[model samples]
Target chain A: MGAVTTPKQDRSRATRQRLLESAVACLAEHGWAGSTVTVVAEHAGVSRGAAQHHFPTREDLFTGAVEYVAEERSAALRALPVQGRTAVVAALVDLYTGPLFRAALQLWVAASNEAQLRPRVTELEARVGRETHRIAVELLRADETRPGVRETVQGLLDMARGLGLANVLTDDTARRRRVVAQWARLLDEALG
Target chain B: MGAVTTPKQDRSRATRQRLLESAVACLAEHGWAGSTVTVVAEHAGVSRGAAQHHFPTREDLFTGAVEYVAEERSAALRALPVQGRTAVVAALVDLYTGPLFRAALQLWVAASNEAQLRPRVTELEARVGRETHRIAVELLRADETRPGVRETVQGLLDMARGLGLANVLTDDTARRRRVVAQWARLLDEALG
Candidate 1:
């Protein structure tokens, strides 16, 4: 009985994971408008009924996908090699400017006017924000207990997100590189 | 000829201005999905034909609205009272976290997935970005000739935009104030 139930659970989890990844891809490529249940199911090679079974509504699907990607991103951040401040900052910039950020931006815009999606998005953003801040604080070796240190950390995160927004609309790589370098310098000066 | 056409031209300009303002209001309140031409025209108290005559297309309407709002915001920035560094920073934060930023965030998200809208949004953003940077540099009286000075200006703008993004999803007023203050302190130290 245990073996049979475990295999079934594993298959169900795999299907759900595939659906979530497909949802993220749809979001990144097509934005909120194009990320439909039918499309996601097709992309995931799952039946519409199966997708519905996993996610009852579009909001549920989107929220699940966002949380899924955030967890993946957080795990990836934690796995990043311990490097110099410049390298770490560059890595963080790359993460923020990538597809995950794009997907999240789409949701952010949708949630701006959507009453139902707002709470979910806000909660997810706060959770992700805290995790990312934690990782960044560790990487920068900043003393969070200091008076201005936490704000500096938050400021850096804000700056990175803003740079990512610019990158979404324009080829902001050069400017982003320079900004990351400057911020690294500032962080070093403040933390030291 | 000048006198005779002036009144008619003025009327047309007023109608167009009303439509653009309505469009911005629609974007800020309703997000991209609800900001249809019909809704904007209704919001502006203009006929559908008249709205179409003024904007030609939905993209035109949105692009026009964004540009109109950017110009208005730029004017407001230019008119801000010159005060101490903290005051100026506070003003900058207010501008970024205001309705214009919310409206622009919607456009940014839409433009990310919209090929035709991307160029227009990107160009408008660059123009607005430059103007904001110029105003900030003047307000701070920072030496643009220095190597890191320009980056600092860019970084502050980026941080403000990032904070605005956060504010969109969450009630981040307290944290935003602190981040702005910390960044201002850092700027004063570097520029002084």
Candidate 2:
């Protein structure tokens, strides 16, 4: 009985996973204006009814994408080896360099036009704020050098979003790296 | 003949100005997605034909709106009393506190969806970057102690944008004031 139940659960999970992956691909390729529920259904190789069953509307699909992107980002953050400051900076830069960041950027562009989507987008933002703030507060708690360091981290994160957008548009690796190192030093100074 | 020339020139310029103003208001009120050429024409109390004569398409109208917004921001920046760093910080905070910023934000949201609009948006961004960089370079040149100052100024400016956005959403005067002081201190450190 247990063996039979395990494969059944796995199949269900795989289906859900497939749907999420398809949504991200569709979002990146078409953006929100061009990515509709029917299109997503076609892209996912599922019936329209199946896509609708998973995500009732375009907004629901976008909401799922936002949550999916956040979970992926948080997972990436967790995988980072937080041994040194440089390590952390490298991890942060790597986070922005990958496909997930690109998909998130596409969602951000989509969210800008759709008022209904802003809440979902901002909800993820608040999640990042609180979670990132917790990490900053913990990191600085042991150090006596810099106070008000959490705000510095938050500011870096915010600026990095704009920088990330610029990176996508211009492909300026040097400037992006400059932003990362400069922000790291600022964090250290603030910590001190 | 002189009277006719003055009024004709003034009338033509006023029609152009009114069209621009109406575009901004329509954008702010209806968002970029909702604001159509017909809607802007209605807002300006002009016929659709007249609006079309002035702005051939929706993209052109939006382009005009962006230019108008940039000019408004420039005018505001010029009016700032650059007597001291503190006043300068106040001006920076003030820049994002009102309707113009809201309209600009709306356009940003809109531009993300419209491929045709992105170039116009990038041009504006480049113009602002160059102008701001020039100002920072000038200040750094004047100050003897500030070395590698451009990076610091740019980072501080980026941080100031986040602070200003927070201020706009929360009406948090105290927070804005603190950010202003922090910005001023950061500037002093970079310049001194």
Best by lDDT: 1
Question: What are the per-residue Cα lDDT tens digits for candidate 2 across A95-162?
Answer: 65555666675665445456788667866756865675555445334252445443455555545554
Tens-digit lDDT string for candidate 2 (B37-100): 8998888888899889889999898888888888887666665554676666566557765767
Candidate 2, residue B115: Cα displacement in angstroms equals 3.5
List, residue by residue over B127-157, the lDDT tens digit for candidate 1: 9989989989998888989888898888888
Error of 1 at A32 (Å): 0.9
| Fraction of the true interface contacts (Cα pairs closer than 8 Å across chains) found in each model | 0.80, 0.16
Query: DockQ for each of the predicted structures, in order?
Result: 0.81, 0.30
What does the lDDT read for residue A76 in candidate 1? 84
Please give the distance, in angstroms, between residue A105's alpha carbon in candidate 2 and its true position after superposition: 5.4
Worst 10 residues of 1 chain B by lDDT: B1-10
Best by DockQ: 1
Task: State, as a TM-score between 0 and 1, how close model 2 is to the true structure.
Answer: 0.82
